[model samples]
Target: MIEDIYEYADPRFRNLTLPNTQLERLYDGCRWAEGPVWFNDGGYLLWSDIPNQRILRWTPEQGVSVYRAASNFANGNTRDQQGRLVTCEHGTRRVTRTEPDGTITVLADAFDGKRLNSPNDVVVHRDGGVWFTDPTYGILSDYEGYQAEPEQAGRNVYRIDPHSGEVVCVADDFVQPNGLAFAPDGQTLYIADSARTHDPAAPHHIRAMEVVDGRWLGKSRVLAQIEPGIPDGLRVDVQGNIWTSAGDGIQCFDAQGTLLGKILLPEKVANLTFGGPRRNRLFITANTSLYLIHVAVAGAQYP
Candidate 1:
């Protein structure tokens, strides 16, 4: 039963999940699974195995299969307004798009004549803009990516103009920006800071910001502080709840920044996304495996 997988901090959380559904592991064996994106056309899910340098796919009819090998150590993935795969690559230190025709197009790799530290996570706005995080993690170690020094002076969140092909720095003060997601209405945005890995005492919280004129308002307020583990990836539901990865499992928060409930996992969750036919199923990419669960709410669908 869902009760076996979740612990509720608020009674309202009871309505969010079913009493009979349980978490199911779809596949395992990856060194680390970080990003999980669903393809509506084929009803399959694609996720990145960062340390393995591969992207894996899963479907209901078949189990897990290699989606792309030597995937540039891709970390985060999403679909654009045109339904193409947009990815953040640690090895390549770039954000790229996989076209429907099987061609790869570089979206962004550098700014101000300097190479990016490493693009970590990415999201596509309905406005056709591509937003992503540039963190030093990929360049800091050889396991996830090649070891190197920071090429850019600051780690910042960037927005790529859909038409102008220009990259703009939306926020620049984060030590390590990890996961990000937008509300269904596109008015509010949430981003997680996982800087604690380096500082040990750094703030491990998800920040909220207002989006104005398709750009981050440049001001942030802490939405939630995750203990145990930092948030890596997240997705917004139609009800505006923020579902984020936590140390032991996934936590769901309401718009008021209230902790609603948590789905407990034995492994540390790295990231998650809402997928499936109607987007009510949540695809979770934990440390070394992919898990799924049926939820009562639907994922946000933007026009």
Candidate 2:
């Protein structure tokens, strides 16, 4: 059972996980599950089935349902400050938002008149500015999106101004920026560089940068080095620890870069988030299924 999958590196990790709760399989039958976001008001979870070009919903009572069909090969989903749905599209190669009235608005698609490679993952700050990662995975193959040459010279992480609607490249030196999360205080930004998938010699680590005046101030320093697999997606706990998806399972690291522990799973996890009533439930998006586990800590973001 998944309850027995816990492996502890430091003794403090034992306190974060419980011994009696079993991992629950919420749903299955997805091509590649990613970007899990929970709606507390509606009591449901929304996630992307990237290859299927759709977004799916999982509720406690109704089971699995189609939230949005023909999602433009959406890859990531998050709620903005006003509770709007912000998404990164692989096929459309853009970032979009679903307004309160159900109208779809394109948040970003191009920079400097050059089309983006493909928007992969997205996050929204309290100030309503949206940050996302642009990579070529969507345009490199048809499995995720259409095959085409990259219009932009380099794949970068960009930030869109909430008021001006201006998109600016916050960081562009990474080989591939996959996952990102802000600290509880919103002073630090953590990003995962999983370039090893394309270049075996590249580093598979998460980096931390100080956020200054809505821009990255200095060069990022290594936060944690993941082995056996790369860090795909991550989220921060209230205590500022990072819970990242790994090839084997979920790895937990402290704010000071200490490996706390790992919540092992049977499959490769792509992304995860803390949900449930009090944000104590950890929802995991693995290769083909969605899994959930209860935790003592709550997610730092969201209600």
Candidate 3:
């Protein structure tokens, strides 16, 4: 059924190839997993099991291990411009960074003196700034995180200056912003609105906005409307293709927002990242398991 839902041989994806490569199941048995991050220095992959309240690490040599227990219900993670580990914590309702020396630093927990609802996905810009989405998905119930009063009226996306601790609201009109990533050229920012909790008639969609002078300055356009499941997290390859995790599996789209291919998995995927020796291996966190595939594309070289 998933194969039927994600077959790419359709004329709509003429430029894409539906590789016969088998989808390998790496690991499983997780409770609400999300946020797959690649660490080249350690040659490992890290992901979060929010309901389990732990961060998991997997390596070819050591297999899977608990990287951190009680990880504050981390939801998403990425490497900063300086190669530090940045994370979104649902339990803590903040964004944090893990320094090279293994020290934890709170990046942004509140804005305008009010606590953030819950930090979700994060990405770094070429200008040494960090951008992340904030929604109440983690705070809406006790399954992912402890439910608490929303410190703000609406959810928003924010940018944090790497040099200064200045945090600014970049986008504030989304019903529930989830995954986000920049184009390879950094001129466009793509964000996914799950909107599962509000306005059911509004289909979940991925939208793109132009970046001007380091700020989002254009009207948002719908790139793709997801059905059955919503888009969760995404990354851009060097060729400008978008690798995003949807309800069925991971979907690949060209720069023009045309669906290219789909990597269907047995379980629902939450997030993923490109890593490995060549940076062409896609490490996916699906449900409670970790899966990977070698692709013909490379991820953006963020340094």
- Which portions of model 3 show Cα errors greater than 4 Å? 1-6, 9-20, 197-199
- Clashes by residue pair, model 2: none
In candidate 2, what are the lDDT values of residues 1-303, reduced to their tens digit? 224788888887878888788889888889999999988878999999999988999998999999999999998889988888899999989999999898999999999999999898888776777889997889989999999999888878899999999999999888888888888877788888888878889979999988887655365799999987999999999989999999889999999899988999988999999999999999999999999999989999742
User: How many residue pairs in model 1 have overlapping backbones?
Assistant: 0
Tell me the tens digit of each residue's lDDT in model 1 across 226-260: 87788888889999999999997999999879999
Candidate order by decreasing lDDT: 1, 2, 3
- Candidate 2 stretches with Cα past 4 Å from truth are 1-3
Worst 10 residues of 3 by lDDT: 9-18
Tens digits of per-residue lDDT, candidate 3, 1-303, equal: 135435673354424333444555678878877898888988988899899999888889888899989899999998986778899999999999999898899999999889999999998888878889998988888988889889888899999887898888988888899999888888889998888636677548888888877755476788887755888888888888887888778888777778776877778888888899778788888887888777666888664
What's the CA error at residue 125 for candidate 3, in Å?
0.5
Worst 10 residues of 2 by lDDT: 211-220
Report, for every candidate in turn, its global Cα lDDT versus the true structure. 0.90, 0.89, 0.83
Clashing residue pairs, candidate 3?
none
Q: Pick the candidate with the highest lDDT.
A: 1
TM-score to true structure, per model: 0.97, 0.97, 0.93
Q: Enumerate clash totals for all models, in the order shown.
A: 0, 0, 0
Error of 3 at 248 (Å): 1.4
lDDT of 3: 0.83
